[model samples]
Target: MARLRDRLTSLSQPRYLAWRALPLGSFDPRFARLRIRTLVMEWHRTRETPDDKAWCEQTLEALGHEVTPGIWSGEVNGLLWARPRESEARR
Candidate 1:
């Protein structure tokens, strides 16, 4: 896991690899679950709270995603592409 750690560390900094190191995954079910689990754990450790559900919900909303009580997934391209309100868009 040294390689993964090294990669994570290297990409965690403000550099060209930052975006690439975001732990994003694709069609691979195992890797996708792993990335989500790791992100949740890290977020919890850093925040010192296990209330990520709220944060996730808010973020999804801000990103124009439609959140449902029974479905709170973090799938790829899960968030919606928000558009400004009618008045705001016209401004």
Candidate 2:
């Protein structure tokens, strides 16, 4: 039946994967970096404006992430690295 198929599809989806992938307790620098890189790539692909970039940066800051320039694949790019803010790290 259609309802049964829909239920099977929902069950097959990795719904809990996001929770499992998240760090357990303490801040995760690697995860932060990856998130920043993903955001940067999305911005590039979408040709986001500077205002949008700034908004993203602000959101990261609000979430206790510090964005910085770093070398990625032998090239310098802004937001290549993201780490927990010093204040957040001590907690």
Candidate 3:
């Protein structure tokens, strides 16, 4: 199954392994969630093309996320927050 394959792939990633190895008893759940979200956003930003805003929009839509545009350092940029598509959200 795709989920299983994805899990397996994550297990092999050092960053995922390190995150998993954090002491759960001492780790704040809110901080953990924020850290993961920030990492994912940074990953997307690294792949973003400065001149190609459309590419960013299309990529996020395909991944079922709605993005908000923001001003960053005089450039129009995005602050991404992941949410399910309307059809999926109703379910």
> Candidates' TM-scores?
0.27, 0.37, 0.34
Cα lDDT of model 2 by residue, 1-91, tens digit: 9999999889777531222233433333444433322222222212323343344456567667776544442212233345677676766
Best-to-worst lDDT order:
2, 3, 1
lDDT of each: 0.35, 0.45, 0.43
Ranking by TM-score: 2, 3, 1
As for TM-score, the candidate ahead, 2 or 3, is 2
- By lDDT, the best candidate is 2
Candidate 3: where are CA atoms >4 Å away? 1-48, 70-78
Candidate 1 residues 1-91, lDDT tens each? 9999999888766422112233332122232122111122111212332444455455434433444443233422232222333333344
Off by over 4 Å in 1: 1-47, 71-91
Better of 1 and 3 by TM-score: 3
Model 1, residue 34: distance off in Å is 20
Highest-scoring model, TM-score: 2
In model 2, which runs have C-alpha deviations exceeding 4 angstroms? 1-42, 45-50, 72-79
